[model samples]
Target: MASTAASASPPPAGWASDPGVSAPLRHVRAIIADHLTHGPTDPTLAQRRAWRDALYDAIALPPDVVSTPVRDGAVRGLWQSSPGARHDHVLLYIHGGGYEIGSVRSWRVISAVLARRMGVRAFSVDYPLAPEAHFPAPVDNVVAAYRWLLAQGIGAHDIVFAGDSSGGGLTAAALLQLRMLGLPEPAGALLISPWLDLTNSGKSIDDPPGYDPFNPRAGLESFAHDYLAGHPATDPLASPLFGDLHGLPPLLIQVGGDEALLDDSVRFARRAGSEQVAVTMQVWPHMFHEFQAWAPDLPAASAAMDDAATFLDRALADAR
Candidate 1:
């Protein structure tokens, strides 16, 4: 049976000492840390998009994976698939940039790799960003893409939802919305370093035991403000960490043990488990926020993707 227990205890004791953090991984971490420290404190939306894409897209995708642009209804994204991938199974991916930045092209480094690894097609949605479309817009876009998938004859049991950072939060909100609509639930979900708490109320935000090169508290506050657009931060759809998780599908939350948002996954797993949801939360020691994006070079990143592929395969097989 699948483990429902949440992983990783609080305070993340001595995560920086993990031997798995190789020299290349440390160099990558340093580069990102320097960029976060010295880069523009307040960047325009265009500049943010350019910088994020340039940085993330630098991580190349597997050569065998093919990518194609997709535009249908409210669903705008990239479809990535490897040779011999299953046509019956699909991975609905949401790219993360705090709901402000990130695009389908930028996230191919992640979703595409998972597609190749799982031998399945992955649809990475390019949802409307904050300041462009706030509140429920991104959530609605995800729901519409899901509906489009079903229209293509894919069963709910053959699909698995996955997202990183804010996209992860959006995935959670979308699941809640699906439940509310009385729609069939997908097989399961993978939340990658999910930023589920928009209020920045988690203790890890203020005091993290390990180094996290992501945005500071004020930056997160600004992003949340833009996305919320006067909506209450505590609103379930806006912040799933603050929402009722009952009846949601099984969840596998993979978070970096060293990321400041570690508590977001830890606390979310705790609450979901308390509500009888099957939750598997893995805290990767010495990894930073969304470290899975640095795969091939980072051993831990490849390992994380390996774990994700295993989970996705098992979930879909069990559903069958």
Candidate 2:
């Protein structure tokens, strides 16, 4: 049964002393703590992009996966698949950058691993960013990408949408858009540490920061401001937590317990269930935002991928 409770109970786990925390992650955490204590507060968007990409690229992809650029009119994205991928199954991956910073290149390796491990073709869209494009632009891009996938002869039942952070927000937004457009639902969706509430109004946001040192409330506000650019933050498309989630396909929502956006996912799960949507909200103890990006490096990340692969595979297989 899906949880319709206003507040979700935190899952049982030894958050503080998780042995799965990798040496690399610990080292990275220390570095972030040090940076928080002594690094520059405001960095140019370009600088942030470069730094984020470098950090993401540090985790290598399996050697055999192939990646290629895809351009269908103004819809540009990256397509990834390994030798063993099931051609009939596809994953439309949305990269998280708080609607501003991420790119297909920045998220290449993790999506590549997702493709290889799940044995499905993966497409990561290069949606328009904020300060350049505002709300509904990226939403439109994702809708177009879905149509493009359909044009590729892939059935809606074979597709799964996966995203993290703002990309996860977009996934939820796109589902609502699809319903309004009368398009068929995909097999399912996977949301990793989704940022569903644009209002930045979550209990975790104010709770003293735990293991997460990167996501300052001020930094999130910056992304929201750039993305909204004077638009109301409560717009349904801007914040899916406020949107009606009826008739959407099954959703697997994974959020780290220590992050500010934990309530976004929890509340979303609650609301979706109220609307009778199938929702599985999984909370990882002591994890930070978008931690799955460190896949194959962090044991927790890899374990999350396994759960994702299982969910996507089953959903695609069971599609009516």
Candidate 3:
């Protein structure tokens, strides 16, 4: 059965001005401002490493229940409410860092929230970043992690793949790659403001001043150039929006209306519908990418996550 929470109320006008802006929104804005101010000025390698470390240190995660290093050399993280918790259902979480930064630790809160909301354990993978690893490597790591899950006896129907931003793009790409490999599709997938078009074809991406607080056009273009190296942007694996959507599991996509990636999600939904894939797409007005990560305090962010949880529950139930 599908379940949902009431949508969170919008923040008041000029909410950003008050010293007492909601704690979650404050944190969210700080992160965004930091990215904008310091992201481009730092030496590239140092910036990448700092971003990686900050993301890892930001979230408070539950104690590790299991740690498995994949045979292919990627890090596999398992966390649950309790150490001995036996969970058949699994969430394979891929962290987003524009394809250059982000690790399992960086997204601990998001994974933890999903784990609690879905009543399942979550396994986050620390995939290799670009410039060092480049395109296909992250996808390869995600696929390898999925195979590792299967090797541990987790059925495809019991697994739900999820990611935010670049990781979301990777989740979609991984599904396409899985189909190409003749592997069974997972039960469902969730994407938050996925960066699906490295080609930067989305007109919304170039929209005027401050539309998306987090993702700027120039920043994204730079990241894409770094991540893809010399690869063609239109390659289906590199940009999943160009891939065939047939036979993939149900999908839930949440994106901010103001984000440059807005069109990516909209176009993806259109294609998925044409391909007869079950898809749910939500657009939050005036919000930014991955806003749900600031949940539990930001009413809109919390509501968005609650909706995601509800969608995931229904999809998982249907898989069963």
Candidate 4:
């Protein structure tokens, strides 16, 4: 969902590029194109995992953050924090990879960045991947992780949930699941380019208005299939866009105009807004998927992170 009201800010400056952003940062679209051409496209599980791991492993994390291993029943994750962190506040971060490949190690840099930016101790889940552990498994693991946080004495009001892409869908679904089972929801949620519609029901996905260098529609559809593993894609829990949006926590969603998943965010924002949920949606022009992954280097990414940090700060304050 994009900025639904006048309160939301617009995109960055020049080429919509912030000043001081290097040529490498500005050349991101080209870089992605080049990488895809040279990168392996093997759909084989082993090959796919290797490619993803290599790509994410190359992301450089700042040296000062600490990431400690932790577990909650079947869930495994990393507790990430920086000097700016509050030991009492917790963020449950779910990583994207269509519920298949991502892990806490792969998302360390982003987790660390959020920890510093939001001044909270963040936990990144290493939920079991798909083809091996499909629907319900990943979502359930997220629930388990949240319960673990509760058991640690972190109140629901002190914790926030967040994720990107499929993980974003998981965050929304998990919140819905919690509410269904009489569990308290978190303070709020932050979704980055969330893949909320598994049915590819979003119009923009088929008739995209801008160029998206990555994330082909068919490829994403395939990932959905793998994760569903014969389950119904239209199930509200699987494709949260079709689900009831009422009574969920505050939501802050950021999405790129150029991405195919644009409508997924847009529709979710509209639904949430209709449901009277507090939602601040920011639509960044001409940006790519999960652009925030390159934050502090790319102006757009940094700006998006700042937006998220501000939203979370306000939401947490309101919760308190």
Best by lDDT: 1
Give the top-scoring candidate (TM-score). 1
TM-score of each: 0.91, 0.89, 0.85, 0.90
Clashes of 2: 0
Q: How many residue pairs clash in all the candidates, one count each?
A: 0, 0, 1, 4
What clash pairs does model 2 have? none
User: Which residue runs of candidate 3 sit more than 4 Å off their true CA positions?
Assistant: 1-15, 18-27, 34-40, 52-75, 78-86, 208-210
Error of 3 at 248 (Å): 1.1
lDDT of 3 at 128: 82
* Per-residue lDDT value at 70 in model 1: 92
lDDT of every predicted structure (CA atoms): 0.83, 0.80, 0.75, 0.79
Backbone clashes, candidate 3 = 1
lDDT digits (tens) for residues 1-320 of candidate 1? 10101111112233333456678776676556444434444455676677667777677778888999998877899999999999899999998887887888988888989878999999998889988899999998999999999999999999999999999999999999999888898999999999899988889977876766564576677788888999999999988988889988888999987777888888999999999999999998778889999987888899999999999889888887
Note each model's CA RMSD in angstroms.
Answer: 6.7, 6.7, 7.2, 6.7
Task: Encode model 2's per-residue lDDT on 1-320: one tens digit a residue.
Answer: 11111111222234333466656566555534433343323456676666556656666788888899988797999989899788888899999977877789978866888778888889999999988898889999999999988998999999999998899999999999999999998999999888899898987877823545445677678788888989899998999999988899999999887887888888899999999998998888667777787776578888988998898888888895
lDDT of 3 by residue, 1-320 (tens): 00000101123344444454455666666555554444433345655556545633654544553444333446455444435443888888888878876667667667767666777788888888877888889888889889888987999988898899998999999999999999988999999889898998988877722346546666677778888899999999989999999888999999986677898999999999999999989998767777777675468887887888788777778888
Full candidate order by TM-score, most accurate first: 1, 4, 2, 3
Report the poorest 10 consecutive residues by lDDT, candidate 1.
1-10
Q: Which residue ranges in model 2 land beyond 4 Å of their true spot?
A: 1-25, 31-42
- Once all C-alphas are superposed, what RMSD does model 4 give against the true structure? 6.7
